[model samples]
Target: MSVASMLKNNKLSKAICEASWATFKAMIAYKAKWYGKQLVVVAKNFPSSQLCSHCGYQNKDVKHLTLREWQCPNCHTRHDRDVNASINIKNEAVWLLTAGTAGLAY
Candidate 1:
């Protein structure tokens, strides 16, 4: 979740502000550089949660945040929203790195 959105929630606003996302990202970049590794940031418009990791099918209905679990219409594979998004992110990162367009190679 983006810090801005998290801060919109009254219960989470304080904790979100305390996290200091800018510093966190800086730290991550520093660590990636120190370890000679690349960091990939998927495009903000990428529909990670809506895409089925198993079949590459985009389910527009999954855009509803309340829908946590869904089945791929093309492949009939069940998925947990967050888990599928993570897999999609990893795949996209690898693809970007291999395509010589790493998002943020530190």
Candidate 2:
């Protein structure tokens, strides 16, 4: 087998991630359209990283994508690659929706 084909066959992680992410986002978008629900894409600059998942502490250091794992200097809490960021983003979305401020915030 050629190297290119070998790489394609062995790249399970990337393929799986791409497939799932695409499907999930598409499902949400299509369903929202079908139901006339508002679907907001939180602005790319919405600070998904700098906000601490645990304390809501905003710091500039957290935005560095190179640091997949890092310690929140303020709280001395270590976080996994995307876990803290995902949690913080989800919480923020819920908060904005529940607070009836999603229209103005996103």
Candidate 3:
């Protein structure tokens, strides 16, 4: 899903709109090209925040913003919401990069 679709009826939509995420993304894209690096944007609906970085578990019950810290039920690992989400996003981007090039001769 795209960011626009994911933002519909979402509280963060207003903040994101005010922040000009489109322009930010554009700038990142331009910088990546200039530096010969790739910018891999995960699908907007990806459950990065709900995913456990330690055990690859998805906690669907964590739907409230108030739940800022959570323990992975599978791994029993504690995680800070923002930190875990950032780790998950990085993992997802690395996976995407590797998967996309897995079939190449080089």
Best of the candidates, TM-score: 1
TM-scores for the candidates:
0.78, 0.59, 0.75
Question: Considering summed lDDT, which 10 consecutive residues are worst modelled in model 3?
Answer: 97-106
In terms of lDDT, model 1 sits at 0.89
Best by lDDT: 1
lDDT tens per residue, model 1, 1-106: 9878888999999777667866687898899889988778778799999999998999999999999999999999999999999999999989998998877835
Better of 1 and 3 by lDDT: 1
lDDT of 2 by residue, 1-106 (tens): 6545654775665776678777887888788888877665555577777777777777687667887887777787788748987887778778877887774311
| Candidate 1 C-alpha error for residue 67, in Å | 0.8
As for lDDT, the candidate ahead, 2 or 3, is 3
Say which prediction, candidate 1 or candidate 2, comes out ahead on lDDT.
1
Instruction: Go through the candidates in order and give each one's C-alpha lDDT.
Output: 0.89, 0.72, 0.82
**lDDT (C-alpha) at residue 34 in model 1:** 90
**Which candidate order results from sorting by TM-score in descending order?**
1, 3, 2
Prediction 1 TM-score vs. true: 0.78
